[model samples]
Target: MAKARSAIVSSGPVGFLPVSITFFMAILMLLPIGSGASNIIMPHLVMISIFYWLSSRPLLMPYGACAVLGLCIDLWLNVPLGLNMLLLLLTRLFVLNQLKHYKGRNRAVHWGVFAVMSCGLYLISWILFSAIHSEFWPIKPVLMQWLVTAFSYAPVAFLLGRLRRWAW
Candidate 1:
């Protein structure tokens, strides 16, 4: 007798999903909003996607890929070099380490963890940028950025969750 395949976790790597998601994020980042006023926060898009894949399938989106994506974001956004890269590495490590906590967790739990991770990512980038630029980077801006990033997390998480549940 032949066996049936499940919709969850097809016979392939997670790199494909993260790659496509990250690419989509980069495009959204480039889109100009309201004549360059109050643009959408996209850095967390890739990060959230990366964190999802990293937490869900750490073997697929490893540290190297995370580092590369972070470097790309840094160069593309003209932010301080190595800052995002470091955060990417750290995020990957955190997810990889905390995989057990995510098992069968609720959506709010996952999204909340992503938001907290976003805060970490933003703080890392800010500290690195301030260290290099020697400018007064206030906590409020970072807090606002984290809040905005938290807002952006829902759709991506929902889509990813559905994809994991309904796709092969």
Candidate 2:
């Protein structure tokens, strides 16, 4: 009985894993690729991390924590304050609502859903940026961002999955 209890406790969620991983990924997203490519091509690593954790361990990553991580990203990227916060919060809510359907689904299903969510995220971001700047920004960058983010999801999910298994 004691051994079983220990096993259960060991497999339980760790509070720091979500926050630290999100923050680390957010910081990584801010790093330059050194390829001299435009910033638009940079993948939103933080969003990928958020989605992974929220899907796998929702309780470990609360909405408030998501907001905080968003704020950090916004500040780090020098974007308008609260922009990332709102988006991250919305993403978290969306994933939480859809998580039940995802429970027994295959990885391909998760990737498809993530692609859809990434599209919505880019669209909303473009709209918000246009609204803030009072001018329609070029759509090309947003499209590039969406593409890069979508393609990068597989590797990010794989790494995060490993981490999740290790943590649990």
Which of the numbered candidates is closest to the native, going by highest TM-score?
2
- Tell me which residue pairs clash in candidate 1: none
lDDT of 2 at 134: 100
RMSD of 1: 3.3
| Clashing residue pairs found in predicted model 2 | none
The 10-residue segment with the lowest total lDDT in model 2: 5-14
Return the TM-score for candidate 2, rounded to 2 decimals.
Answer: 0.89
- Local distance difference test values of all predictions, in order: 0.73, 0.85
Cα-based lDDT at residue 120, candidate 2 = 97
- Give the per-residue lDDT of model 1 (tens digit) for 63-146: 777788888888987887777788878888888777788757887887888888778778877777788888967888788778
lDDT of 2: 0.85
TM-score of 1: 0.82
lDDT score for residue 130 of model 2: 98
| Over 4 Å off, model 2 | 1-13, 37-40
